[model samples]
Target: MSKDSSQSFLLSDSAMQAASYSTYQNFQSSPTLCASELQNWKQRIGLFQTHLQTTATPTQGSLFDTTSTQTSLDSIKPFELRRQNTEFWRWQFDDVGVPAMYFVIDYIATAQKGPILLYIGETVKSNQRWKGVHDCKRYLTNYQQAHRDTGLKSELAIAFWPQAPADRPARQKLESQLIYKWRSPFNKENWRYWNTPFITGKEP
Candidate 1:
């Protein structure tokens, strides 16, 4: 086998072993949530769970793979941006108020920088979020058609807090807070990373 392939095998083996060890340790040290905390988490789940149920009805195929409904690239100018798709990947890491994990699109000059566009949004469901991204991509295309000088690319980064507790309310609140807090070059208000708004759903 080639040297690259051999190295990949070694790395894969190491990752598997590390994961196995981590799982064993977690199984040994599980903690229980207090009653009050659990109740709050349940409430948050109920509100956002509806978004999931509504979107789950099925619309189109995988948004990332198909171009049938995708926006064309020739229209919009590409913007310099970066995306961060982060996931906790561990149930034990989840905390009640804090986001268990997130996929962030940081619009800056970073190693992960990619194309950019206008208006970014976050969703609880992965597929729905991806569809949102597709829409952004299309928007970028249309934008280029409208203003050729803008020269920005619309990009999407999908992250999930799968490790987050299944309690829908807590997860929704966490995600909304994260989005509210998210900071990017394109972020107009600069609300995230500061005392902006909670999940009040009201304009701050």
Candidate 2:
């Protein structure tokens, strides 16, 4: 037989013998192979070890490596609330050059606790805050009327977080997470207080 074919037959025979001795005790008690076959087996084992070592050592810039993974994570900036205002409408328009998510909060004095999140929303154009005013104005008016009728001391304010301009999906994801975390009453999906005025046709 050719040299390569002879080597393959020797390796296959060694593997079959190893498999036949199923248990660890059986494998240890099995008779040793001839010197030539034993040398071939040792050489194959050394080659496998070298292959395993090469594969286990990560090459630089590998996508699955720790350094590359950490660099990807570091690229993402944390979301932070940049501006807050009680009269968001009165705030002058400035092109922030980023998409933004905003929160409508109510400072309820009667509750004697911190501000309560009323609604969460996002906008692709940060300067075009007016585009969202219709819903904000309506909710605020209804909230004020309802509070007035019940004699609860409350004031509305908006908080904003500007995010990188191209990430509209990220902004929306953040909005959903915040809505779920705060359980905002006016958010339609988290409609805990959907029966509140202006939402349930109880406009004041």
Candidate 3:
């Protein structure tokens, strides 16, 4: 389940620029004056998706292997992925929850090809996982806000994997598998696959 960077699929100069230093804003205008730079990031991600769809192959790695991820997503019924307004932290049950794996995805991109898996993680306490300060929360907010500001729609939501292993290490291993398989952008392991522009860090 280890997909390393040994594969030799190269992105275009623009995409590379977006993925590396994230120099898009240098030649682009801000979506909002004091807002996080996410609109441009979304545009860059869309370009990456379009290019990868026609060019990606099995040997190239699972970073853009949408077919498998799409199939996996299809297996999960719509009812499985739950949503409870913007402040999703409240979705937890009675302050206690079973250990599980969670997925953050956006459904609005289905018309283009398929839904986007933005992030994945395993938690011993599913309900408490998103209850407090979480970096992914900020990332998701930036993502959804960017869409709203740019006049686009994004059906963002979270879904738990019912078969997640109760063991923490096993859960984490499975979590990593999904993250690499789907190339979820918000996950740090996947930042190399995409620019991760929503987050403020040393990397692009």
User: Number of the top candidate by TM-score?
Assistant: 3
lDDT comparing candidate 3 with the true structure: 0.54
Count of backbone clashes for each model? 19, 0, 0
Candidate with the larger TM-score of 2 and 3: 3
Error of 1 at 142 (Å): 5.7
TM-scores of all predicted structures: 0.27, 0.50, 0.59
TM-score of 1: 0.27
Off by over 4 Å in 2: 1-83, 90-97, 192-198, 201-204
Candidate 1 lDDT tens digits, 145-194 = 32223332222332333333346665654334333322221223332422
Q: Please write out the lDDT profile of model 3 over residues 131-195, one tens digit for every residue.
A: 65577766765665566576666776666655456788767755665665556788998787676
Across residues 1-204, which tens digit of lDDT does each residue of candidate 2 receive? Answer: 244322221113333334332111111111323444433332343343234333432333432336644343233222223324434333343333246566666544223233455677777654456443255455555555554554455655565554423477655655665554444556777554233333433212
lDDT of candidate 3 at residue 58, scale 0 to 100: 30
Which one wins on lDDT? 3
Question: Can you tell me which runs of candidate 1 are displaced by over 4 Å?
Answer: 1-148, 152-156, 183-204
